[model samples]
Target: MKRYLLSLRLFWTTALSAQLEYRFNFLIELIAMLGTLLGSVFILSLFFSHGNKIGDWTWEAALVVQGVYTLLDGITNTFLKPNLSEIVNYVREGTLDFVLLKPIDSQFWLSTRTISPSGLPEICLGFSLIIWSSNRVSNGIHFDHIAIFIISLFCAIIILYSFWFLIASTTIWFVKTWNATEVLRAVLASGRYPVAAYPPSLRLFFTLVLPVAFLTTVPAQMILGNINLLKLFTSLLFSIIFFNLSRYFWKFALRFYTSASS
Candidate 1:
């Protein structure tokens, strides 16, 4: 674990240096990320302009969900999304063999090799939103709720990475799995709002089948003191299941990878 951490730090240090060399592109990407984060907030604000609240959430609670989505989305951009896209490119270009031969874990290398240092600005932006939203709530933040929210957020991240892994791993079977990632991005947009904001059928589909409810909804709800035990347990259960299944599927997928043989 220590070695992996050290290697990861070294990798990021190198990646950061590389991005710094491309100052023009780096700045453009940073500005783009900033615009995207603020755009989500703008949309949320527009929604609240029409009414006092969204579903069971007050405007403040809805903002919290937006903040959570922004944070998680930054994380996904920094880690899973880029890696999955790179993996697809590797498959298409017949370069995946190089990754398999690397000294580090293939998953770790694939995940961290392409760090988006530009997304750091967006992550800070998201953290600011969460703090700003927290201040607006009348109910004082509870230490216990904070703890639970942290745990829920952790599980949410796991579920998200697992979902991405499932899509990326499909390349072992279907070399052209670019459409899968596109579909995932479209599906994940639903998490930007309160799941209840959608109809009962859509909400049930997200909550039970897709698990997006756990990603942006449950964590913000937990922080708002609105999380039920059942929801907490459900998120935890699905996260564990998805996390394990993704890892297992990765291994399964590797069996079909002909690599250089192909």
Candidate 2:
């Protein structure tokens, strides 16, 4: 564990150094992120223009959901995209062989090999939105609620990473799974709004099939002090199950891996 931590530090330090060389990109990313956030909020406001609450969620409460989604999106840009998206390139170029031959765990190496600091602004803005909007809500924010939100958000991240890695792992067999990942991202975009805002059928599908509810809604609900123990337990259970599935799936995929020599 100590060795792994040391390696992670080394990996990220190198990645950060490289990213710093392109510091100007940070301003571009920040502007784009702000525009996206404003657009999302604008679209959401269209729903409440006539004083219509979406699935009974008020504007402030719904903003919490948007905040959660933004936070997750920032995480994807920072970690998941930079890391997992390269799996196809690794497989196609037979570089995964080098990854597997390393002294460290391949999954960890692949997932934590780089950092994208451009997403840092989005992550900060996400927390700011959550805090700002939650203060205007009826329940408001409390220390306990913040604690629960942290735990819920952590579980959400696990579920998301597992889902992404699960899809990316398929590159072992399908070396060009870019479209598959894109489809997954499209489905995940639904998470930017509260799941309850959807129709019953879509809500059921997102909850049971894609589990988008756990990704954003559950965490937002926790922050809003609508603590549902059952849903929390379910979220935790799903995170564990999904993470294990990703781990084991990667191992299974490796069984068919053939290096460049082969």
Candidate 3:
């Protein structure tokens, strides 16, 4: 375990060094992202100006939902998305063989080999918005609420990772799954809004089918003191099931890997 951790630290340091080699490009990308985020906020403000509250959630509540979603999205984009998106390329180009030959767990190595420091801006922006929204809300934040929120948020992160792993593992069958990651992004993007804002059928689908509700909405609700015990338990149960299923799928996919150019 210590060796694995040490390897991960070394890998991260290498990735950081590589990124720093082209620091100007990273800054440009960060600026572009900031602009895009500002545009999104402007659009949301205009929509809320129409005074339409979707379901029981007000615009303020929607802001909270988006804040949590953005924070989690930043975490994934920083740590996992870059590597997972390239897994198909690694498999097709035979680079994955190098990873497989390593003594460490290939999945761990592949998933954590890269990190995007640019994502830190989005994470900071999201937390700022979360704090601002909490202050605006009538129910004051309490220590217990914050603790539950942190716990639920961690579970949500696990759910997101497992779900993405399931999609990335499909590369073994498809051999070119770049489009699959895009599809996964589209599906997860919907979680930026409160699940209650959707139709009943869509809500059910998000909660049970894709489980995006547990990823952002449920955790945000827990912090807001609006989460139910039943929902919390359900989220916990789904997290466990999805994680185990993802592991099984990854193992199954590995069994079929013949390696490129073999």
User: What's the lDDT for all of these models?
Assistant: 0.82, 0.87, 0.82
Error of 2 at 25 (Å): 5.6
lDDT of 3 by residue, 159-239 (tens): 998989899999988988878788888999998889998999999999889999998899888878886888888888888
Candidate 1 clashing pairs, residues 3+ apart or interchain: none
- Better candidate number, 1 or 3, judged by TM-score: 3
Candidate 1 wrongly placed segments (more than 4 Å): 260-262
All candidates: CA RMSD (Å)? 1.9, 2.2, 1.7
Model 1 Cα lDDT, one tens digit per residue, 7-92: 88998788778889988988888788778767766886786687577787877778888888888888887876766688877777
Model 1 CA RMSD to the hidden true structure, in angstroms: 1.9
Per residue, candidate 2 scores C-alpha lDDT tens digits across 1-262 of: 9999999999999988886677687567667867866765576576457655678898778888888887888888888899989988999999998899899889999999998765665687679989988888844579999999899999999999999999999988888999999999999989988998899999999999999999999999998889999999999999999999999999999999876555
TM-score of 2: 0.92
Query: What are the TM-scores, per candidate, against the unseen true structure?
Result: 0.92, 0.92, 0.93
For model 2, the superposed segments whose C-alpha errors exceed 4 Å read 22-51
Best by lDDT: 2
